[model samples]
Target: MEEYEIAIIGGGPAGIMAAIAASQNSSSVVLLEKNSSLGRKFLLTGGGRCNITNQKPIKKLLNIYPQKNFLKHSFFTFTNEMLLSLFQDKGLNFIEEDEGRIFPMSEKSSDVLDILTDYLDDVVITYNFEVSSITDDFIINDKIKADKIILATGGITYPQTGCNIKNYSLTSQPLTDIKYGLVPLITKEDLSDIAGITLYDVVISYKKSKVKGNVLFSHVGLTGPGIINLSNEISQGLDYNLLENDPDFDIEIAIDLCPDFTREDLKEKFTNDFQLKGKTMLKNYLKLFLTNNFIDFFLAQSDLDGEIQLSKINKKSKNRLIENLKRFAFEITDFNRDLSKVTIGGVDLDNINPKTMESTLIPNLYFAGEVLDLHGPTGGYNLKIAFSTGYLAGLSASEK
Candidate 1:
């Protein structure tokens, strides 16, 4: 039987960082991975480019997470700036894209993984070591004994990447109800007519939650950052089993095609355009405000004649057009779980020490990454959480 001072399970970003941190403290560390190699899911982030972290300020960054106060310590401890700086010092160049998203200059997620793994020279990395059991004495699989254990096993999303929640044996700690997070919504409306069209800076709202970003028209429904973010907001407390069993189970969402302008504003614009392009067809006039394909679908949905002249449009038809543009309503029936970016729930936050990432219910047992109930929106927020919490957990575990 082999022994070590620290055993970090699940070699995703969190486990990898935990092993690195523990090894830096001169503690013998072994990183146990279920997969053949490390970072299988990590390479899939940001479409393989890897949006490492957001460059937003701490205050603004904190607002993204649902549990802001709980993450305050970890965010302050290992900030986005610090994460970027760590790579920068190690000769990694990065580029900042839209919405302050930072990506490696090489635009390869493998490069980011390389930097992380390079730091774990002193740590033992055991592949295909799925831990079957963990005793209270801190022994794993009856083979490895450790003073402390860091469960960096990620949430159940990409199971092929080795995220099997069924394999987890920490029944002593309370695991919160899990749901799909940052998943795309499957709309009831068939948007096949304008499937490839993307609306930029559009507003998608459900109840009081309104999200503004790009929305993509898919064959099945709406997608892209705008709808995905709104899905995250409305998906909370949703019963997935109920959603699966009841086909009628769904939530209604409203999309503002022209969010920058109000209905009255759109009416005014239409009035002016009608005066200038009086002889122009209604569909031709709509081209100024919307795409050709979307205009066809919009006109058909509104039961309006696209062949009619702009000047011939009546007050009722014009009002309906403006209203639809301002508030296009649809029903969201289900989520695209296959493309879900993150898992929403994990071990309840109440049972974990936010500052140290240690389990309050179990001594010398720590949790990090998606295994905890912490998650943020798309664009590197979740990755930062993984890295930050992993660092804190490893640092705390290495101490006496």
Candidate 2:
């Protein structure tokens, strides 16, 4: 049996960091991964550009998480500044783009992975090592023994990236009822003609909760940051069984294309446009506010004619158009779990010690990454959590 000071399972961000932190001294730390290479899923983050972390201040960053208080210690231990400094010290430059998402200056996720693994020169990394079960006796793969253990197996989001590990009782929660997080929403209404249209500065709402950001009109429904965020909220509501029971859970999503304008404001704008171009087609006038493709589709929903002259437009027609422009409602039928950015639920936080990422029920056993029940919106928040928790777990295990 191969014995080591530390045995870290699942080589995603958390496990890698755990191994790195544990192996800082001459301690024997073995990182076991089911995949052939490390950071397989990490390569796919930020549309393959790798949003390494956010550049937000620590206090602001904490607000992005579900349990801000729980992550306070870990974030304080290894912050976004610490992460940036580590990579910059390793020759990997970063660039802050839209939404304050920090990415490698090279825009290559491979470069980010290289810097993370550079410190693993002396560590033992066992690829294709799928540990079936972990025993209290420090047994893994029914062969190895270790003084401390760290479980960083990610949640079941991308099976291709090896998150769908099975045949083992790794997490105390087990995360079976997997609902999609940060996924595109499916609408009952198909805006196929204008599916590819991208709208900036729009407000999307489901029930009383609303978020304002960019929205992408997909053939099935809506996507992008705003839509994806609402999906996460809905999924959480479902997990807590709040959807069916809550009287306000209508599942009807509203997109305010002209969020900056009130209904009266839009009405006035259109009324002024009508006066400016009296003989022009309503569709032509609407082109000033919306896309050419959306003009026809939006007109259909309002019981208005695209060919209707602005001069002939009535009060009722103007009111309907304004309403549609302000609150274009779509009945969200479903969201694709397979296409989600990550899984929402994981090992329950109640069983894990937030300070050390160690299991409360099992001594010397730590958990990190998506394996924990912590997730955030689709920026670089998840990656930051994974790295911070893993770092904490590594330090705690090494000390023990």
Candidate 3:
């Protein structure tokens, strides 16, 4: 048996960081990955560019997480700034994009992976080592013995990338009900005509949750950051079984296509345009605000004619148009679990120590990343959580 001070399972972002952190403390660390290579999902982040972290202040950054209170210690211990500084010290420059999203200067997720792997020089990395068991004595697969074990096996999302929830029962701890997070939603209405159109800075509101981001119209429904973030909020308390059994289940959401303007604002603009361009066709005049592809659809939904003169528009039709532009409603029916960016449920947080990332039920056993019921919205928040928790788990394990 190969014995080590620390054995980290699952070579995703969290496991890799755990191995690096443990090795830095002069501990003999071994990283086991099920895949042939490390970071299969990591390489696919940000469309392969890899959004590493956000540059928001620590206080503001913490607000993005649902489990902000539980993550307070780990996030403070290893912040986005600290992570950026570590990469910068290794000669990897970064670029900060909109919404404080930070990416590698090379714009390659492979480059980010290279910088992370460089820190594992002293760590033993075992590829294609799918661990099936972990004994109470801290023996992994009855072959590798370690004083402490850190589980960073991620969640059920992206199962093709080696995320198997069934394979995560190495410990007897209870797992929470799982739900899809940051996934694109399939709407009841077929949006195939506007499939390729993208609405910028659109506001999607479900219940009290309102998220603003770019919304990409898909053949099936809605996607992109706007709808994806809103999907997270809508998926709360919804388990896989409930969703699977209820095909008719749907949630109504209102999308503000013109978030920059209110109903009155749009009405005022329409009134001025109608008076100034009385002879102009409604379809031609609409080109100033909406795309040509969407004008016909909008006119049909409003029960108005595109060929109608602007001055010929009636009050009822004008009001309906303004209302539809301000609040376009849609019913979200389902989301593909395989396409979810993160999973909402995992090893219960109540059984884990927030400060150390150590399991309260089992000694010397720690949990990190998406395995611990922690998740955040897209644009680098989830990756930040993975790295921060992994670093804390490894650091605490090494000290023990």
- What overall lDDT goes with each candidate model? 0.85, 0.82, 0.87
**Residues 1-400, candidate 3, lDDT per residue (tens digit)?**
9999899998999998888888878558999999999999999999999999888999999987778999999989998878888889989999999999999999999988988999998999999999999989998888999999999999878889998866557899878767778998888887888898877887889989899988888899889889899888888835453213432345788878788898889889889989999999988987877767878777776678889898999999899888888888887778855688988878899999999999999999998898888999888999999999999999999987
Tens-place lDDT per residue, model 2, 1-400, is: 9999899998888889888888886369999988999999989998889987887899999998888988999999998888888889988888898777999999999898898899888688999987787776888868789888888888777888897735225534444344568988777887787788888878988777889898888888889889888888777766342112321224788889787788878877777888988899988888777867677778887788989899899988888888888888888777755678877766767778888888888788888888777888877888999999999999889887
Please provide TM-scores, in order, for all candidate models, with all chains considered together.
Answer: 0.94, 0.93, 0.94
For model 3, the stretches where C-alpha displacement exceeds 4 angstroms are: 237-248
Highest lDDT against the true fold, candidate: 3
Task: Between candidates 2 and 3, name the one with more favorable lDDT.
Answer: 3
Q: Using alpha carbons, what is the TM-score of model 1?
A: 0.94
Clashes of 2: 0
Clashes of each: 0, 0, 0
Q: List the residue pairs that clash in candidate 2.
A: none
Q: Which stretches of candidate 1 lie over 4 Å from their true place?
A: 167-169, 240-248
Note the residue pairs that clash in candidate 3: none
